[model samples]
Target: MQNIGKIVVVAAAALSLAACGQQAKTETAAPPSSAAPSSTAAPATQSKGRECTADDIKTTGKFGEVPTITIPDDCDPPKKLITKDLSEGTGEGAKAGQQLKMNYLLVTWSDKQKLDSSFDRGQTFDLQLGAGKVIPGWDQGLVGIKQGGRRLLIIPPDLAYGEGGNGMKPNETLVFVTDAVAVTAA
Candidate 1:
């Protein structure tokens, strides 16, 4: 079973590589289990090529379910990180050094492409806050998120993968809708 899991991981990596048309460097690795969903189909809404703001991005879903994220066709990427809590959660906020179990949907700001989603996999991604386990945007933006809350993060290149972008476009700004399912001490 472990071998099967490894095979699946390898196959998923290969598919991601093929989709991006290049090999991803180690420094650009995304969160664990960052596989693309079976379907890469475009969203039902077409972009009207309007400038996007934090308000332009929309999300609809209940906590613990996969969220639907809609991004405009094109937008000027923010120069700094922007974090907004769409729905506030109860209990203590997540802190650095704690483990966060989250469901997230990642999209690019440039072309509004869906890059990765934890909801599609029917699993939550666990990572230690500020542990360097993931990108800087996640490390910085995800702090203080309470359980059951949904947060929107608009990350510029510097806070994200920078020039590498892992399998993503170079210097791509990333839009993430993250649902904080749980938080525990690491």
Candidate 2:
């Protein structure tokens, strides 16, 4: 009779311990898929935002009166921009006021020729991510990337310098090889 009682107590304790082990596993696993997860947590790559495709860009390539643009494949522009949270973004990153530091080189896809460049400087320019601080194409192009990563920004004139092109030239589409070096607030 005493042995039977001891067995019952041991069985209860073992069952409780097993339940605890299960709870631990559940707690540590990544939060359910839908939650935005934390900022530092790498954003899941499932969200597609407004960044234009080479096709969309090439199609919309002519803006205002700028020039026709052609972006190289090596540029790495997203076929479709995939958006996920960075520490902060206004609208999938397209909205105004988000600030970022980046390194880039501009090129033409038609001849795969280097058009203009910033990468050669090994410098990063600080600009508002979604803000009008930069051109609309840049504003629209950066819509869906996280901080500390690189993406190619291809700007058609409509999204670029546009019609008069800051007086540098008139209506020309632009292509950029952007390295999103860092992200910060406006």
Candidate 3:
């Protein structure tokens, strides 16, 4: 009878240890940041309680080159998605299910800092339009962009990463300057 009691205690202890190990593994397996910035750029000051406008963002540099984007110190971010064409393309516009090759620069609205740039890496990002592979903003905003066109997209948190912004603050907005390099229809 004593041996039976000892066996029961041992089984309970083993189950407890196994549960703890599973919990530790689950905690350590959290998803990694998706938009890890390559550059250690400084963060921008908080906005002055105003919404961001197109005038507050300035982009300079020729098409197909790395652009220099300037955001004002007091600039605030808007709540909706905004897409502005910097340079219009000459050919047919891109459609859904089409594969697109683009060079892009990404910046966080709250920090006004560059997060990533395909131009800096000297490679174009390839993705299919209207696909769920990317954020909702990119899937919606990149449609109808012509090949060789340059565009600026201001994405709100709902359209971006939402509460899990990864490398950025929670619910942070994003700014992107995208240059369409090539397109292949599906």
Candidates ranked, most accurate by lDDT first: 1, 3, 2
Clashing pairs in 2: 63-158, 65-171, 66-171, 66-172, 67-171, 67-172, 67-173, 70-109, 98-129, 137-159
Per-residue lDDT of model 2, residues 35-103, tens digit only: 222233222333344444544433222111122335434333343322222223222332356666655
In order, how many clashes per candidate? 0, 10, 0
Deviation in Å, model 2, residue 78 alpha carbon: 14
State the lDDT at 105 in candidate 1. Answer: 79
Instruction: Identify the runs in model 3 with alpha carbons over 4 angstroms from their true place.
Output: 1-49
Off by over 4 Å in 2: 1-95, 109-112, 166-169
- The digit string of per-residue lDDT tens for model 1 on 1-186 reads 011001112222333552221243211234322433223333344545554678877888877767777875455556788888999999998988998877777777767767666677676666667776566777788889999899999887666655432455556677888889898888
Each candidate: what lDDT? 0.63, 0.37, 0.62
Worst 10 contiguous positions by lDDT, candidate 2: 1-10
Q: For residues 1-186, could you state the per-residue lDDT of candidate 3 as single tens digits? A: 011001111211222332211233111101212233234433555658888787678998767989978777775688888898999886888888988877778777676777666677576666667655556677778888998899888888676655532344566677888899997787
For each candidate in turn, the TM-score is 0.72, 0.46, 0.73
> What is the Å distance of residue 70 in model 2 from its true position?
8.0
Candidate maximizing lDDT: 1
